[model samples]
Target: MIPVIKKRIYLGLLAATMLLFAGALGYIWLTFFQQDGGWLRYITIVAVVAVLACLIVIGLGFAGIVLSLVSEKNITFLNKPMNFTFSLLYPVVMWLGKVFKITQDKIQRSFVEVNNQLVKAKQGKLTPDRLLILLPHCLQERECPNRITTNTENCTRCGRCPVGDLLPLSERYGVHLRIATGGTLAREAVKKLRPRAIVAVACERDLTSGILDCIPLPVLGVTNDRPHGPCFNTYVDPDAVEKAILFFIQGGEGNVFHVSAN
Candidate 1:
């Protein structure tokens, strides 16, 4: 199995563990209140039942996500619910990772991987004009005087940064590529362009956040490599970006293009 799929299975297990842990605590609470009979007991029962129902829904959502990962296509009806459940569970999963002494980046990267798979499973044909390649501003050389945040076309193709390569590729593909300095600007670009699909590149944290934030919007995330450290002169494979572009532009039909696990 692919590493990302394994991580997703592990993530699903973690969510199940969280539910079991909650159930255990609830059981202990009920045991402590066994001797009491009053409105408090009724409230406790209601709360426990409610929690149980939520757990059931979340479990189904996890199953949906897992099934989508293994299947060729996403279950159209479950997509929104799965994404919503993921959004609800993300923070809790991060906390669980901490309890288990797992690095946040690892979990975030796993989340991105699973998200990418889900998005890819839902892939459909899109005109190049309707596609967007959203990139983080950190991909730019820090020392460069030119700022391409507001307008990527301002880039002079100096070859010092990935943007130099990406710009020409975007032009060749006739897709809109925008470099965003932060989340606010990124959202603005999304809002203004209203692309049907997006190919986003960023670190684990931002990519995870962006995936959650752009729920119901297909986003194929390619994690950037942070060589110098967090957010400084990060690098992404331009070829990966192209593959993502092809995945969408070609409608991802019949193995014409494959979304890589990297």
Candidate 2:
């Protein structure tokens, strides 16, 4: 699910650019009027107005973020806009952090943490059928020959992979579960399934991107565990997955399923 916020962000950026251009023109007009020493007051007023307009655009973005944090009912509408604001602001924030020599990883982690809180705030509105559990193909054992991507029922419950437990959990909860290889397949699955909410498992990068892509759709991201290395033989805590699932299913109240990794 590519973020629906892309077009919105593009439009916002376009508007900001126009405002900046107007501000520059106003500044130039003000400078020329100062040299001519006539009608300089009008040019100065125009420049101040243009600068204030630019500041208002920036202020609206920050306001969106703050409202997203404080207002739970508005989460459905505000989340995507807030994500767009973050996308626009993140690079600048990172650059300033770098200039100060602050750690980028910490900054990213903080962003993810805040994103998660916003997601959780909206989860209370979801039901079981509207929620989906999205898994990564890397969660499967490398040596396994089964292709669970097309049909999870193909899994033999071999106990070697978390899919063994996940299969039953999905069936028990009556939730749609799909294993996707990459963003394209994941987007396709999301499109076909048409779920209102999603619980996604991946690395921090994938989780962050997927969350952004699936804006306005509440998504709780759980980072997978990589014991051997990245991509190959990656794992996730089944309890964590189950908890996330139940958070939407049971309105954030359910017993944690004890998962056994045999």
Candidate 3:
């Protein structure tokens, strides 16, 4: 398994991350102390500080998300928002890690252990045919920045996406890739698909849910490469996608690689 935080590296990153918040505090202090020095100056300082604080909050949230990507560890619990819900709030459910001191490394190891169970299931140890794959349309035309969702009408089955590639693999392996519309759709779709194993692909956004929703059903996350943006000209790491399929179908012989934001 890939080392999750490389303790030393994360120590440094943790420090850098704290600085963003610190900057916000320090700026507020400096401005608050200087208030009444000038109306224009006070307004300028506060405005800048407010904007900086907004950015810091976002930076902190994104940093946390990237942290999730670094470690595929099982995050069993989460938290309610701090009363300031905004863009992509549900993903913030992971902030419980901060209070819980969750280690990303252990989470990754846990996933491997779970997948190993599925591997055992594949060895005639259990004859289970049900298998579900989450194929979030993290795909787009090679040159176009349009994200294509699952539609026989739109995709044209041109094989331009992992979804396209997954179609034939599903036919050959008898597995289904649920092209979910969103996190909610993915959750419901998985319930209906009800496979014995799951091979899920998503941006880091839906990964943990993809893993958690299919409890005991061995789920693997494949974060698609984002040369542009989410769903916009995006592509699943083909190697990762294929390996997930292979690992699910072929057992111990198949490789299950780790997700890395670095």
Candidate 4:
């Protein structure tokens, strides 16, 4: 939902930053070669080299993003480099997006999409026991008295919310399932369970941040539906969750449980 004007502004600023660096490098080179200096020439050369190296890395990172979007085949080699670059650049990109008055939700959705691409590029698979289904507490109905954060078995399977359906899904798939109220609890669950892979459900912001936080863990993020509001009475497509689980379990072999990039 980012405005076209804001996106243009951000791109303009990014281009300007790149040009500024290039200009600085050019000035350093000119100073190093044109002047008959000793240590200063060495210093300028080192600075120019460093700047050139940074520009090359940034170029590669952007190229990875483009390849992930256009290339149909798996580019597994780009996974780690793209993730590392994205993690390092996200804050600055977000700041510029904000300065340009871009929509926060749009930025977050883009982040999630990039994260998803990076994860898919990894092409990793895990067994049911090594997979974890991490659910946000908001998926629970506000009126429901069940406290399934500690023990999901406390649910009565009343079908009032996703929790009821998720419980059976976890059991059927034999994957670890836990409900976390916040990032702290989610991290704790991840630390304790130590699953090789994760299927996480949350809002756009949380999902984006969580995916970034759990890099190299191969998390498939499934966004939740917010019917009532942002946090309360939120719901997730149980089928989407199932498909994500099956994706890791089955390794994207057949279309029986195919998961889209939603």
- The candidate 2 region of ten consecutive residues with least summed lDDT is 2-11
Q: What is the number of backbone collisions in each predicted candidate, taken in the order shown?
A: 0, 2, 5, 0
Q: Cα deviation in Å at residue 137, candidate 2?
A: 1.0
Model 2, span 38-63: residue lDDT tens: 57767666776776654555556555
Query: Per-residue lDDT for 128-180 in model 1, tens only?
Result: 99999999999999998887886676888888988898887687789999999
lDDT of each: 0.81, 0.70, 0.51, 0.75
Candidate 2 root-mean-square deviation in Å:
7.6
> Which residue pairs clash in candidate 1?
none
Candidate order (TM-score): 1, 4, 2, 3
Worst 10 residues of 4 by lDDT: 1-10
| True-vs-predicted CA distance for residue 255, candidate 1, Å | 5.3
| Displacement of the residue 80 alpha carbon in candidate 1, Å | 3.2
TM-score for every candidate vs. truth? 0.89, 0.71, 0.48, 0.82
After aligning candidate 3 to the native by TM-score, how far in Å is the CA of 5 from where it should be? 6.5
Which candidate number has the best lDDT?
1
